[model samples]
Target: MDKTLHYLFDPLCGWCYGAAPAVSGLLESGGVSLELLPTGLFSGEGARPLDDAFAAYAWSNDQRIERLTGQRFSEKYRDRILGDRRQLFDSGPATVALTAVSLTEPARELEALEAIQHARYVDGNDVISLATLADLLRALGLDDAAAKLSHPDAELLGANQARMSRAQALMREFGARGVPTLIVGSGAKRQLLDHAAAYSNPRALISQLEAA
Candidate 1:
């Protein structure tokens, strides 16, 4: 039987970005059917401006993530994303873009997600912008998804909400508190994997997933 893993994450979340490498490792190990669930934690009403207080807090949290996970949270990201006040720190557009990817090419959704995360944390690009996301998707050879994201239709928007609602429902069911929650197994026999291992030790995280 294929081991099912539910990755509950928010695209704009720093910890979720920190957990990417470990999640990728888990996926690459094979024999696992993984689902990428965007929880919409930092979207809609959860979205906020890039104010000074939040920026400092974000950088501090980001540095901790970098120290623990070895994920690069670049200076450009600090300066451009958190430093620049014009951009709103929102994940709705990026989540919608991922939904578009899911609609067009389901298998490549993870790839699209990684690209979006990299754009924000490494490349320091405006991930909230539809144009930017479209360009990034096109760069990944996902022109169809890019086009959908560039001009999102009703179906895409509805699917985006549905996907997030499902993820959030799973979280509530499992009593999961935050982003990057990993729920393994299937049906009535689900197991919530440890979140600490994702940042502290990815190898251990993968082993946990395999065992689950």
Candidate 2:
């Protein structure tokens, strides 16, 4: 049987960043098709101001994630991104940016995501801003994707919305409460893998997928 892994995540999610290595492992395994589905969890109505209390909470959670996954959540990120109160913690721009890449250069979507995540968590760049997101896309040599951000096509917007809806529906079906949820297999026979293993033991994750 053919297998596919649907990775549901939000760009601004620290746990999703933590899960990055395992996801990359799955992609590199060549065992199954990998589909990235953005959950839009921190976009639109889900966005909120970067206030003091939330920044502290986010940094603490990020530290724990770093310990678990060994993904860097730098002090620069802590002071600049989590400290900035002027901009909202919105994943809309980043999501749209990835969607643009998915639409224009399908093969490079994951690369775009990894770059965007690195820009936010490591370099302390504002992935939440359109201009910054455009620059990141350009840096990755995705000039077409960078251009699309300034004038998004209707198809791009629709695809993003549809993907988000499908991801959210799957989340509800699985009774999952947050991002970094993984569903292995295709169609009705699909199963939800243990999300925690994506951070703790990626080899086990590959084993599960190979079995699936």
Candidate 3:
């Protein structure tokens, strides 16, 4: 039987940013089909202000993630993204952007997610804004996705809603509580890979997926 991997993550998640390398490794390895699922953990009703306490906590956690995964968390992001209180730390726009890519350019969905993450976490861009997300999609040559943003239809909304629901249901099934979760295999034989290995060791993660 063919093997597949379902990656559940939120774009605003720091750990998800850390797990990017390993996810990339899996995509490049060509041993298993990879599906990117956005959980919408930080979107819609879950959105909240990036208050000082949350900002500090997020930074501290981000530092640990950087140490573990060698991903960069820059001062620019800390100052511009975490420090700015004018905007809410909502993942709705980014999630919609990824869904747009998935609908229009399925093959490039992963790339679009990586670029959106990079725009927020690395370049300190406001990815939560539709305009900013459209620009990011365009920069990635995803003009179809960019166009969809200007005039999203029921199909796009339904797809995004269904993806979020599926991701949430999967999390419940696995008793998982956070982003960057991985489910390998499929149907009754599927298994949840250890989330820790996604950042601590990419090769080990690949091996685990292969074994599953």
TM-score each candidate.
Answer: 0.97, 0.96, 0.96
**Regions of candidate 1 where Cα sits further than 4 Å from its true position:** none
lDDT of each residue in 12-113, candidate 3, tens digit only: 999999999998887677767878899999999999999999899999999999999999998889999999988798999899889999999998998898
C-alpha positional error of residue 69 in candidate 2 after TM-score superposition, expressed in Å: 0.8
lDDT of 1: 0.91
What is the Å distance of residue 130 in model 1 from its true position? 0.4
**Considering TM-score, where higher is better, how would the candidates rank from best to worst?**
1, 3, 2
Which one wins by TM-score: 2 or 3? 3
Residues 77-191 of candidate 1 have per-residue lDDT tens digits of: 9998999998888999999999999999999998899999999999999999999999999999999999898888899999999999999999999899999899998566889
Question: Distance from true position, residue 54, model 2, in Å?
Answer: 0.2
Clash tally for model 2: 0
For each candidate in turn, give its C-alpha RMSD to the true structure in angstroms.
1.1, 1.3, 1.2
Candidate 2 deviation (Cα RMSD): 1.3
- lDDT of each residue in 1-212, candidate 2, tens digit only: 36889999999999999999999998788857878899999998999999999999999999999999999998889888998999799999899999899888988888899999999899998888889999889999999999999788898789889989999999999898998999997666889888888888999988888777
Candidates' C-alpha lDDT: 0.91, 0.90, 0.90
